[model samples]
Target: MVPDPDLQLQMVIKALSETVSTAVDPGNKVAQEQLHLSIATLGMMRSRLPMTRRFYRALAQDALTLAKDLEEKTGQSGALTQAMNDVGQALTDPGIENEAIEQSRARLHEAITDHLAQIDKSLGTVARDIVMQGSLGSIERQRAWFVESGFEPNADRIPAISELIQTPDHP
Candidate 1:
């Protein structure tokens, strides 16, 4: 039987915590500091593990939307069509792995980027406007992902990462 990845992570975190508590010297500032950082890092990973699938799924959905919108506006096909088809296939798989979803999102995003470059070369500002508008939702979701880092001055104004991930449109 396959060990659940989430449970494996929890086991690792628990083992690390136990080792740090019993073996690490309290008076050794360097080891203690490293241990603290390691624990925090593990904690962050633990928090994010369950959301990985949802996050990638939503990102894949956003890419699909952007690709469809671009295709409609430009009346074009090629790489965009192929990327859309591939991602659509990936998204439809009920047991799709998170890594597969991430890979699909990356491929779709790359196609979108390449398409945008071509548009910039030929269509100029019009393409830029469409891309900017279409990409805002993705940009907002990425920003929400980092809200916990305390870098955003108006962090309180931003929606929680979970809220952003659970947006109605994505569901």
Candidate 2:
């Protein structure tokens, strides 16, 4: 059965609230777990949403706030920091580059590249082949798969990536 998107969004907000309330101790295992889980949940929600600029902005704002809170409490750089950076990079407007945003993106990109390399090493050839094969299909085919997998067909708006991913060659 399909899940209610509104309900899922509420759950994500509730999880974020709970994480904020219990996140006093940066080293606390429970708090760390909650924070990570909340982040993952938010990412999933963002992926499922119709990709309007407003939606992206809202998600970025929430993630930025959460990342700031985590940084303040932990006094260290980690996944939250990287997530914040990625959102910032992904949301940046063209021809209006900011130094801080650029720096954050660079750091996050480097970290993710390292992580992906580690995964590639660990998962070996079979996983790599599987991932490559999966990614080789057209976006329309992927959309069909999403529909088959029970995603709502009538997304409120076209995903922002549809516009952003287009290049002169493709267009």
Q: 1-171 in candidate 2: lDDT tens per residue?
A: 356775677666777767664655777878777776666656555565554333334333433444444344334346645666675665565443344444454455454334345443544554345434433333332353243233655754434444432433222
The TM-score between candidate 2 and the true structure equals 0.25
Whole-model lDDT per candidate: 0.79, 0.48
lDDT (tens digit, per residue) of candidate 1 on 1-171: 356876777788788888656798889999888887777677777777777777777888888888898888766769889999989998788888889888888988898888877763666666777788888887878778766655789988887668877876555
Alpha-carbon deviation at 20 in model 2, angstroms: 48
- Would you estimate the TM-scores of all the predictions? 0.78, 0.25
| Clash number for candidate 1 | 0
For model 1, the stretches where C-alpha displacement exceeds 4 angstroms are: 1-34, 120-122
83 in model 2: Cα distance from truth in Å? 2.8
